[model samples]
Target chain A: MEFSSKLLQNAVHEMSQLPGIGKRTALRLVLHLLKQPEERTEHLSNALVKLKSEVNFCKKCHNISDTELCEICASTKRDGTVVCVVEDIRDVMAIENTSQYNGLYHVLGGKISPMEGVGPQDLNITSLVQRVKEGTIKELIFALSSTMEGDTTNFYIYRQLEGTEVATSTIARGISVGDELEYADEVTLGRSILNRVPFESSIKAT
Target chain B: MEFSSKLLQNAVHEMSQLPGIGKRTALRLVLHLLKQPEERTEHLSNALVKLKSEVNFCKKCHNISDTELCEICASTKRDGTVVCVVEDIRDVMAIENTSQYNGLYHVLGGKISPMEGVGPQDLNITSLVQRVKEGTIKELIFALSSTMEGDTTNFYIYRQLEGTEVATSTIARGISVGDELEYADEVTLGRSILNRVPFESSIKAT
Candidate 1:
């Protein structure tokens, strides 16, 4: 193929390694870069190069940050008494987008999967226990997925903080979303029935 | 979002700016990068930064190259007397993959689209005319598309080289591919029939 330059060809090859991008798409992107002002490509390249060099993990919550601590961990307005545990940074983004909770987060990096050879030792469980040992945290929320590995990880963390004052809770999976009572799955319906709340406010919207 | 590091966010943001990539896809790509060693991200970043800085256009044919001339232009075995003009570098790769043509190529970068405000001046047409005037080229093949803009660009170039000794030609378009004779459009079928070669030559396998 008659590439305009060796550097362009090399860039296309590198880009083609990405998921869903073929040689043609890569070439198109390179050609587009050629048409754009040099600054745009420079911006992207600088960002990429500085990504690992300038950025570091927040020592407290594992969120990305320019400094030692993430904004959430460094903020006094956030509830430090409540800790929401998750499997990865993506879950933190999901929770943040909802804007429902104002508590802190603990990213485990991954869930426990015995078959995959990843156990509690491979996760950030020790650091989490050290947080609970500080004695100010009241509730430990397990916002993990309902998958088997996620459940296993949740149970492991629950057992670790069993004797502590931190009362553990998990996100309920019943009545989810837009489904009516009749349309709910049997397992979900059963879970909802078992975890039913006591009547305090009128359901008829008085 | 709880990112592993600040670089992760920056990388994802840059990736998301590409033509079709979205936030989630960018995040996925960044996450994949994090899983690999430092060299992977560094390699890609270096390639991107060096793409424009290290490469320039081939002065003679306008193809991409590290030197003043591209591989096709530099190759001694390729047909220097014939020039195939195309809309973009992707077309160069497509034709090269066929291994059927050994002629040189000229990349126009784009077709002349009045709606997009692209004119002849914006393209590499002047260089093409200069090349024709040099008197080394014989066949000037217009391998551009059959669309209105493509046709207009071809006609414009044809007019520009009117007095030159070079013989201008357009690539044939007919009932493309596996199209049945019954379903073929009138224009295509008529052209195919009118341009049909002698049965004796095509009957024997090449």
Candidate 2:
């Protein structure tokens, strides 16, 4: 009498376990998928199965790739002497899409989080240190989020690479566009003033 | 060498085609699926395929079911003399969840919409009229949304059954709970007053 199949309910429950999806939203998505052609859902299923079967981490950067080395690490035009360290493979793709950074990337797999029981030993920091010890990299850039755990992880990495002779730098943090001064918190205001740089080509507000 | 697997990318793209899901959210969901065990995604895929294959519309009321005649239509306990008409199967499910009505149902499949190229012919109106003409149904209740198209469709059905002896009525529309007089629209305010009944208790403000 009920429209809900046990198998369908099981699937919806599994999907709702993912981040940002509620039970109602999961049901909506499952129903939408049900209305689609059989091949569409099958494609997603095959993809899920093939992801682990066909893909592996690049030996050099630890990013998910089909080859031994990822495209960025394998490219000759990239600056191998400068490495941009990120928290995940998604970050690497984001920076690559901007076409602003031509340096090789090293994914830390995840940021250090003591609350979540994830420590430095859980990350690919050992491989990063090994790569730095080889003495090929001239600079290491940290492009992590400005969260507490991200900052703590950055500090830990800095301490590890302090005496290695590799110049370390973090991305510039400041107020974003269309932000209000009154709404800006004290921490953001202090950081903005502390990192203030010279303004060139100044124009009057209309 | 691409950061995303081709299969994952295609699945994300297909999922993004559904209502309310964009590329970024789709990618996030696909990544979450990738992190889970293979059985989880397999279950979802199988459920989607099963949903389409295992369910069909009832021959009598057009309600969704695993058999030719939906459970509601085949139930001897349900009143066949009274039929509640609705726009879709979801509405039938919604009403069933309330467990307040013991009458039968008639699903219109969709309402009349000229702009969207839908008309009276697009619905199962012919069968509804035939059912009414069979002299079995004594009462017909219109349980549709209070939208322009819903009103138009309701009017059309009423006109079609004008000569029939069966009693016709529409569900009362009124202001929802916690109504603010200042914010109440004219249509809702007028409806609340027009459909006003004897108050059993005094209003208590929380």
The deviation in Å at residue A98 for candidate 1 is: 1.1
Candidate 2 lDDT by residue in tens digits, B78-170: 999999999876688788997878999999988899988899998989999999999999999999898889999999999999789999988
Q: What is the TM-score of each candidate against the true structure?
A: 0.82, 0.85
Q: Which candidate is the best by DockQ?
A: 1
The collision pairs in model 2 are none
Cα lDDT for residue A8, candidate 1: 85
The residue ranges of model 2 lying beyond 4 angstroms of the native Cα positions read A1-8, A47-49, A200-206, B1-5, B119-122, B159-163, B198-206
- After TM-score superposition, the amount by which residue B153's alpha carbon in candidate 1 deviates from its true location, in angstroms, is 1.9
lDDT of 1 by residue, B16-130 (tens): 7887778898887776666567787788878887886776888887777788877889999999999999997778888998887999998887889999999999999999999
Docking class of 2: acceptable
Model 2 chain A is weakest, by summed lDDT over 10 consecutive residues, at A197-206
Calculate DockQ per candidate and list them.
Answer: 0.50, 0.35
Candidate 2 lDDT, A102-171, residue by residue in tens: 8999999889999988999989999999999999999999998889989999999989987799999887
TM-score of chain B of each: 0.85, 0.87
Error of model 1, residue A35, in angstroms: 2.7
